[model samples]
Target: MKKTITFLTVLLVSINMYAQENLDLLTYAHTQDINFFNSIKNGTQVKEYITVSKNSVKIGDTLILGTPTSEEMSIRTYSGSYGTKARGGVAQSRSTSKKTYEFIQMGRPAGFGSIMAAMNGDAASMADNSLKNTTVIVNEIKTYHRGSKNKPLYVVMVLGELNGKAFGINKYLSVMDTELAVESGEILLKNRKMTRDEAIAKLKEAKELMGIDMMSKEDFEALKKELAPIITYKNQE
Candidate 1:
């Protein structure tokens, strides 16, 4: 019995190790991506169903895709002397005139949200992402590494094709200074097992009703239970 248990434990550990190895470990620079990164890591600790990674994904798995945000960068130029003026009479850091340009999110993602985001961004949101109601299923999973560092960044990209139902969101978070092209934030990889978008919307409505005492706690609870699955990213931080 002891030998059997030991072998089982070792097998389980090995399986987990293999899964982690096949997964992509990525880093995010934006607030939205950072939050998503943190949430995915934290969420896994609290729930079970699946973990977001390449190894766990297979062909035909439905996925929510991210849209393009800011693929361009603007320039800011400044000029001056060691003072306020080009020939500073007063003491100040020699600065020049100023010219600045930035990419801002208009709270929307450019088209081709699937390929672009998968290649560049770190996360995707279930709610308020680029393609609201449109669904994508995995067509391919590609893995690669970049950079010259000892630990190169490994990316496992999911190439998806539209399942085609509906698209668009009631609301979406925007990246500052970017106007369509790439939205590098608010990528939601965390999920609540919902079969329909209306389910989440209904839950939000119910919560609102409960808050205003239009619905009793018991009634809201009942509704929530019937809705099954969990959350809606209505006011996520």
Candidate 2:
């Protein structure tokens, strides 16, 4: 019985060590993510603007706006006979091919009033409306390095309020905010690693703060699952 107890104690120690190692790794990753996010938030210092159309705005939704110069391309093909009629009499062959390219404008930022009008289905009346541009409070910024190292795509979420309601919107901006805009506003930006318990508590607070019930059930579940791993160690501790 004494030998069994000794072995159990050793096993328990091993498990504890393993758990600690995992916790350490998680803390490191969390810290890295937070740091990267802050670098994007704090690194750049210009305030540029883009024009968004009235049709695609949502209230209480975070808006991700790209610069004014992004373009989307579409390729189309057409087929036809160019050769002379090849009836046995003409003795001619026929070949057919055609291609077309269409370029669409994308990533344009919209004025706050236009967005609000679009959301309210009053875009027509607001077509010539002149409203001062509202400032966007950026919350998070991420970048994707595609192909060229110099020109990476930026993903950003900004805090916006319209019609007296506040919410977050995520947008893919061609230019990083840090590259073009200075951070403004009083949103608390997380800059340090959080303990599992603290992280879980923050998640609960965010849910209530964001009106989780207003989000689709699927989205709420997915958000919970995404944060679950970070907080999973809470119960074990």
Candidate 3:
């Protein structure tokens, strides 16, 4: 009986150790593809989700990606540096750089308003105010195809980060310059989930709401010709 109990205890210890190893592996996996590099400043705890080779980078500064000798990804600044330095010195140092490798969210954005904010650059209210520990997805717009007569509508599903800060909040926590794109006649927006069909319907509805003529046969043909080579990214299942 004592031996049996001892065996059980050893088994439990092994399980715990295995669990710890698994956790370590997960933590290690998180930093495997860090693209952003930040220079350490003021000793802030750098966020794990956003990778920076250096813990802090200065404001209005350009940080090279991959290597110091490599191409410039994006210029960086922080909210902490703003008035004193760049206003959002901490924030700016933490946000993903434009040159950083772009990533798409695994699935649609979690909410409609969030999607809208993402699309319109109003994500500050919706996203965690802290740029350090946030996740934003970005996909390059590949193509825009006007549908056939039967389809009669266009579909545009934006799946990735529109730009830095997910929705317009700059590294300095200041409002960044914004550009608007019309998706299906509605401002291309984010922070919401749209199935392929729903995206199509919304775009169609937007067109109708805007009083734009439905795609004519010729327009549809021309649109398809236009979309022939644009390669958009899709969510990976």
Candidate 4:
């Protein structure tokens, strides 16, 4: 009985290790070939969904996408000496410039009334008083297939309201940005589990890239401890 138990434990561990190696290879492949990742097609038909808090929106309501400007300054200095022994003074001047090209508009304006009517009055609302506070909803949705199984890749346009004012929030939903993408219909795909040795190797490479040397020893230990479970392999089956 003891011998059988030990053998089972070793078998499980080996299986877990193999799974981790597969996951690492897949992740590496996706990073190397983005078009290959995006080319994957799934059979799922994408649908639009919306969630809102506050008063219902209608047609003719204005939606604003505000983009604040950025400014930078460059300085130059000159030094000169005249009519004095070992006397010199430095003068410096700076010119301020603004960057106007970084602004991005995700989508064109759509009337709130027309949008609500188009959906056959499918809507939601939440009540709040602060003029600056607003609830955002995915008003327009598009999808494409990505990955080997052709999983759906959802891109959505977000709309919001502050007080009685309507506005546009974002054009694209991306995983790198925030968790809100999930609410906006972004799909989360499963990755294969990794084994202990493979996890450690991958983590070491990540630590080097993250400049762990820049962190205090305590901070480094804290971060590692927090991430240890995430990097460690577990049996999914």
Local distance difference test, per candidate?
0.37, 0.33, 0.27, 0.34
Runs of candidate 4 exceeding 4 Å displacement: 1-106, 109-137, 145-154, 168-219, 229-237
Tens digit of lDDT per residue, candidate 1, span 18-64? Answer: 23222233322211343433323211111111222111334455544
TM-score of 3: 0.17
Query: Taking the tens digit of each residue's C-alpha lDDT, what string does model 3 give over 1-237?
Result: 687557556644532331221111111123222331111111112111111111221122222111111122345554555355554325535435232111211222323333345446653231121222232232211111122222211111233232443443322111111111111211212322233445455545544644555555566555445443331214211
Encode model 2's per-residue lDDT on 1-237: one tens digit a residue: 687557556644532331221110111122235443233322222122211110111123233322223222335543443467433433343554322111111121233433344456652121010111333343322332222323333322234434434422322111223222212211112232344556678677767856856566566677778777767654331
Q: Which stretches of candidate 3 lie over 4 Å from their true place?
A: 1-213, 225-232, 235-237
Name the candidate, 1 or 2, with the larger TM-score value.
1
Ordering by lDDT: 1, 4, 2, 3
Candidate order (TM-score)? 1, 4, 2, 3
Backbone clashes counted, model 4: 10
Residue-by-residue lDDT tens digits, candidate 4, 1-237: 687557556644532332221111122223234564455332211232222111112222233322223233446654454457444565555665543212222222223332343346542221112212123443332222333434433322334344534433433211211123222222211222333455578657657756856556566577678668855435211
